[model samples]
Target: MKKPLQKSKIPSNKVFVIKELREAYLDKYWHSHEEYQLNVILKGRGTRYIGDHMKPFKEGDLVLTGPNLPHVWRCDNAYFDPESRLETHDIVIYFPESFLGKDSLQKDEFEEIRKLLARADRGLEIKGHTNKVVIKMMKELVHRQGGASIIGLLEILNVLAHSTELEPITQIDYKNNYTAHEKDKISEILEYVLHNFKNKITLKEVAELANMSESAFSRYFKARVNKSFSDFLGDVRISNARKLLQDEDLNISQVCYESGFPTISNFNKQFKDRIGKTPMAYKKDVIDSL
Candidate 1:
């Protein structure tokens, strides 16, 4: 078996593969392959990267990604601390988009599932009752054999196809500009942002990092990411702000400042614009859920 960090190649003879992983960190490099993927973080906290989207991920987060949508679940910095003892558990299922046979999904019985596959092109985060049920089924699936495994997969897919709880993680038209060198360049940019997003970031800085003129880099980034540099930065900042607000010690103003926003007014506006709620309301919702 290849080291887990390498881009995985699903064996051709298999219809799909399921893995229950317990590790210190996920794949360190960003890459993609031909198989569609459903990944659940059973016990972990990290920043998740999928195409142009970047957000924090934690336990119970379930995401379904279409084939060739570049992604990675990068563990928090503490996971790398030599004295820290932390691990991540993940349940991952990989199957070809046409694994059931090309004609199988063409039938009336599979119509919804076919559409679900199409929506997965931008990646979907499974949530609500659908997430609850499917995660249970997936847990049981890891121990099943042969036909049972296939049935379990179909059960999960059926729930996903019918559920309205699927949250698309990226812009509808986002597409990867896949090439080995380009892959590395994008990965470098993402990693840089992951570490530095708590501070102000500039397009000129990133353009320099990518070794391109600012105009050329702006066009290049917008082409692939389907958003301007500022919008993407806002998404990252708000995501972190929301996460930080979960702590009672961090008031809204503190969260705003700590998450890289210079003012509470701007933070409130961006938070509402991107997350559809004020930071206080969002924190309330999180509390109410508990």
Candidate 2:
């Protein structure tokens, strides 16, 4: 398979960039770049995949991802319709490690920022008041010039570096072996699984898709995510099933099959194991909330 690495360049006249993306939907390609990115979703909802983690995302979501950690945000199906009026808007900041200066991070005052960058290797979801403050700074930087922009960016980073409202997105031990070929392989597997998760998928099928032997794929996935492929699929299915259960029309049995489980018994067991409630009970809770 061809490498889908994203080769993004920053202008020599600029130390970093802050911009807004307004599109029919966010970019769906699973690609990586050479700069750390801070993103705030102004509008839209979708699924986000970063390194070894996959989760739902929505409006106002804020994330910081380290350089070259493969990631993508796949918008909901509604956004893809030409007849639909849906559009996504995002505010983003991109900077390389040397944005401030080549040796800037080595200074005593930059220790916290350096640590923040280290945490960013796993991708971070900024939360609470901190999320609001950083976003405000990002918006301010959009209209700032010269040193003002630099100070604005630094203020945002300083707030991030000192805040406790950051949630790491990937597993604690998630490795960053993001070689070009590895990015392509993982991106392919993610695409296949996400698009086909509602149907039966087999180890051999995904193995062939990645052009690796079944055993090799098994070992590779386990080493990276610390979980077997089947377990990962189960997590994905359960997550989707939770969403489906919110619909009053779909019963537990229907949700089970629609979420790719072969039998309701297995579905119930897995649901309770991961979600801490039986399918019926979970459905009842959703009903009660409404």
Worst 10 residues of 1 by lDDT: 1-10
Using all chains and alpha carbons, the TM-scores for the candidates as numbered come to 0.88, 0.87
Q: Which stretches in model 2 have alpha-carbon errors above 4 Å?
A: 1-3, 245-255, 278-290
Q: How well does candidate 1 match the true structure in TM-score terms?
A: 0.88
Please write out the lDDT profile of model 2 over residues 173-212, one tens digit for every residue.
7777766666667777876787788899999998898788
Error of 2 at 185 (Å): 1.9
Question: What is candidate 1's lDDT per residue for 152-259, written digit by digit as tens?
Answer: 899899989999999999876677776766777777777787678878899999999999999999888777667887887887787778778788777888898888
lDDT per prediction? 0.84, 0.86
The local lDDT score (0 to 100) that residue 191 gets in candidate 2 is 69
